[model samples]
Target: MTSILQVLIDAFALGSLYALSALAIGLVFGIMRLINFAQGDLITIGGYALIVPSSQMVAELFIGDWPWVAMVPAIVAICVAAALLTERIAFRPIRDADPATLLITSFAVSFFIQNLILLVYTGRPKAAGIFPGLSQSVTLAEGLTVPGIQLVTSAVAIVLLAGLAFFLKRTRTGTEMRAVAEDFTMARLLGVRSNRVIMLAFALAGALAGTVAVLLVAQTGVLDFRMGVFLAVYAFFATVLGGMNSLVGAAVGGYVVGGLSVVLQAFLPDDLRPYRDAFLFGIVILLLLWRPQGLVVGKAGRERV
Candidate 1:
């Protein structure tokens, strides 16, 4: 039916955003073996970076026709810097520490960033000021309408995913990154600079998070300081469902989660709507129990030091 197709489009659009965000999380985990809880906040950072500049109508100062391109670079740069700084300040010292310590530190860093934003920007939601054409709907089939922005978002996500695949497969730095993931000590012995590689990982993750933020703003048209909190949960779930260290797995997991969410929303009765997240959470719990490493195989032959 047309309605079903519409739902599928909606799900894929949302899932693409999730895929990018999850890729950010997965990238950090793949290299440093640390979950950057602040990953979601990097998204929040990207959102606000645009919100603040556009709110002032500052885009008018730049080229009117393609102001968005400028915003994209500026926002992504700010987010990448924030991510790198967070890693250096909060994560680098604890790099060799136990997983528990890293996790707690991540949580703490997340809270610190969120609260800092809240204090500076207030807790109110602000419109993200996306391009005008983004919200336009297109008739894909009889009785089916899909948002123009959603299509663009999905296309962008696919392109970025493909580009990422190419980078990981063909580049020397990418090979070194994979080598580091497989065996950090051996990678170090091979003259792989752990510091530089890890920083690059964080940068890539930041760029992905920034892109997701732009897509999210395009879809929702508004953002709140607390937006990062729920997104973090979603990203964590995607990471669990996909293989934690596999980029492709993260993308697949994101779409799967998005599809499952659409299916549930479409079929769930009114009474169960409120508890949908609870059910999904239960599913994540089960998935983690069954395959703690995630659905896809992570970095091949990882050994705990």
Candidate 2:
């Protein structure tokens, strides 16, 4: 029982991280029919923003040295700025382009950010002592222990999810965003400012990415140029698994993916552990085959009469 409980806790924590990332991706996809692959780069930017740029392997804390109250908001702000800038410079001009074009543009932006980081920070990973105290383990029961970071991650996810729900349901801007997502053309005709709504979605997505970056760096204490890649990939899959058209589905999908990953890691033989992702994805493929539309089927896209 204890062992099972431990597994469940671990799964939930990891799932929370994936859920946050998936929500980020889902937000942008909801507003624009574009799959912003560069969302990962925004996360990477958030992590890198914490430390002073250096070619040396060890990263010196810059914004990271500030109190958490100030530090987190600063990182989020930086990512939001980056997201908005990308929208304005890279995406806005080509807003009416086909989905394929938008996807390619996102890839281009991702490569640009990655190479720029390599030029300034080098290819080596940097050790960052971000929120080192969170690494400590906390005892929950006689035989059960949980990492502080995991607990924090779960709590943060819950709060953010609830907060986002309220914002979307209660606020005028949020309503506008929802309308835009449902039918961009109709929404625009009905007085929704296209650029404003789209920019807000990207900004919100960036904030989520920034938050995930902090949680990830706190958990791993290492910064790599590719740190956000796996997270983004998994989140993207989660969005598809849950239902690309629904933000709620994205969140649910994140938890599902996270839970499956933990379960596989625990049950697989030691020798097979290295191939866990392969097996896990194989299972995901099977599941998708069973339910290609996703666990939650979103409403069909509206058509203009």
Candidate 3:
């Protein structure tokens, strides 16, 4: 029973991180009909923002040294700025382009940021000591122990999810965003400013990415240029699996993917452990085949033109 409880806790914690990543991707997809693959790089940038730029392998703490109160917001702000800048410079001009073009543009932006990181930080991984204390194990029972970071991650996910729900349902700007997501043309006709809503979506997505970066750094204690790649990929999968058009579906898909990952890791044999992701993806593929629309279907489909 204790072992089962431990697994559940671990799964929830891991799922929380994936959920945030999914939410970030889903937000942009909802508003722009463009999957911003560069979001992963934005997350990478967020992690890199904490340390002073150096070619050396060891990272020096810059923002990481600040008090949590200030450090968190600083990281989030930097990511938001980066997201908005990309929207203005790389995406806005081509806003009406084909979805394929927008996708390729995202890839271009992603690679550009990645190479830029390599130039500044070099190809080596850097050791980051962001909130090292969170790495410690917390005892919940005689035999059940969970990492402090796991608890914090889950708590943060819950708070952010609730806060986002309230914002979307209650605020004027949030309603405008929802309208825009449902039908960009109609929203514009209704006086919803496209640029404003799109920019806000990017900002919110970036904030989520920044938060993930912080949690990831705290969890891993290392920095790599590709740190956000797999997370973003998984989140993308979660978004699709949950239903691309529904934010709630995206969030739910994140937990499902996260839970599956943990369960596979725990149950797979030693020889098969290396192929856990392969198996998990296979399951996801089957699920998608069974229900192509995803776990949750959106009420109305909007054509992007």
lDDT of 1 by residue, 152-242 (tens): 9999999999999899889999999989988889999999999999999999988887888777877787878877667777877887798
User: How many clashes would you count in candidate 3?
Assistant: 0
Where is the poorest 10-residue window by lDDT in model 2?
296-305
| Stretches of model 2 off by over 4 angstroms after superposition | 54-59, 300-305
Off by over 4 Å in 1: 53-66, 288-292, 299-305
Cα lDDT tens digits, model 3, 138-216, are 9999999899999999999999999999999899999999998888899999989999999999999999999999999
Better of 1 and 3 by lDDT: 3
**Highest lDDT against the true fold, candidate:** 3
Off by over 4 Å in 3: 54-58, 302-305
- Model 3: clashing residue pairs? none
- Give the Cα lDDT of each candidate: 0.81, 0.91, 0.92
Worst 10 residues of 3 by lDDT: 296-305
Q: Residues 1-305, candidate 2, lDDT per residue (tens digit)?
A: 88999999999999999999999999999899888888888999999999886465556778989999999999999999999999999999999999999999999999999998888888888877678888899999989999999999999999999999899989999999988888888999998999999999999999998999999999998889989888999999999999888889999999999999999999899999999999879988998999887887655332311
